[model samples]
Target: MIFTIAHKEFRSLFSAPSTWLILGVLQFIFAWFFLARLDAYLQVQTQLAMVANAPGATVSVVAPLFGTLALVMMMLIPLFTMRLLAEERRNQTLALLLAAPISSGQIVLGKFLSMVIFNICIIACSTIMLSILGLGTRLDFGLLLTNALGLLLLTACYTVLGLYLSALTKQPIVAAMSAIALSFGMWLIDVGSSDSGSAMRALSPSAHAQSLNSGFIFSTDLLFFALFIGAFLFLTIRRVNNNRLYA
Candidate 1:
């Protein structure tokens, strides 16, 4: 039953013209940035040639590539998330789902799965650009994998949060604005703080994602991502059940 609902929701994502347009633009940006970074690497290769045996030089070049992936996700997720529950409620389809035999948990999970699958496509498309970098120089394969994993977790968290926000509002624009604002606020707080004094930075998803992206797969980061996603999703299910009760 869950799979049936998830399959339906997944297919429905393609019905929007904006989804295709946004995807096209996102792919272009990924390709452009990867090439730009490659060109910069080539330009610096000459200077690097002079610094025979510079310590941790390879790490410096690779770090920014992973960082670029993080930047792309931060921008793309908000746009996708805005449409999740907000669009359904705005058009009154959420009530339809609530009235159906499906439980609130199943409905929320179905929507979340659909969004996660869409995100996988985006990440897969971006990999082509990253692959092109491999031909020019040997890149750290593990770093790339870690970077991708971090992005998936981070995006999942964003989707959950967006879904929760969408359930709280009837207006799609309001949901979008609130979700984006909250995400951006967390991002800035996480980034602007010093790592040494980052006791409070643990509250932000981006900070935790960065730790994982840097190949530091700490348990705290994993637990945080899981808890963050689970908490929001649980709240969404609660909201859906409550709405049905009052309706």
Candidate 2:
């Protein structure tokens, strides 16, 4: 049942012109940044050779690329997620969905899975671009994998938050703005905190992602992402159930 809904949502996304435009623009931006990073690395290649334990191309280029993508995804995902449930409610289709035999969890999970699959495509495209570096230099596969993992988790967090917000309102624009504002607020927590061990900083997904961005994966960071995603998914499911009951 979940897969059925996911397939429907996935097809819906592809059918939309905006999805194509976003993908095109994102690919162009990724390519531009990759080239710029490669150029910067080349300029410093000779200097790097003389230094001991110097960072390689992966550290100098790929890591920063992932970092930049993280921020980009933080902003871009709300646009995709805004219309998930909000548009359905606005169109009076959500009540139809709620009346169906499928459970609320299935509805939420299916939509969530659709977005996850879409994000995987984005990550795959970036990974392919970075894979080209293997031809000219040694790439740290471990670090690359870690960055990919972090980005996936970070974006998943964004998706669920946006999904919940979408469930709360019939206006897609309002949901989008709310998602972006909350995301930025969490980012601000990470940025504004002065102490490394500050509890407030730990609340930010960006803060947890920093460790992964640096190629180190701590269990705590992984747990934080798990809890964050799970919490939002639970909340979204509850919201849908409420609609189902009240409809």
Top TM-score prediction, candidate number: 2
Q: In candidate 1, which residue ranges exceed 4 Å CA deviation?
A: 50-62
| lDDT to native, each model | 0.76, 0.94
Per-residue CA lDDT of model 1 for 1-247, tens digit only, reads 6677778877777787887888888777766766676677777777777896852323554556656766666666766667677788778887778778888899889888888888788766665557555786666667767777888888888778877888887777787778888877888888789773467788888888887667778888899999999899899999888886775
CA lDDT of 66 in candidate 1? 58
RMSD of each: 2.2, 0.9
Q: Indicate the residue-level lDDT of 136 in model 1.
A: 63
TM-score of 2: 0.98
Q: Report RMSD for candidate 2.
A: 0.9
Per-residue accuracy of model 2 over 1-247 as CA lDDT, tens digit each: 9999999999999999989999999999999999999999999999999999999999999999998998899899999999999999999988777888899999999999999999999998999889899999889999999999999999999999999999999999999999999999999999899997899999999999999999999999999999999999999999988885775
Error of 2 at 42 (Å): 1.2
Q: Residue 183 deviation, candidate 1, in Å?
A: 0.7
Task: State the weakest 10-residue window (summed lDDT) of model 2.
Answer: 238-247
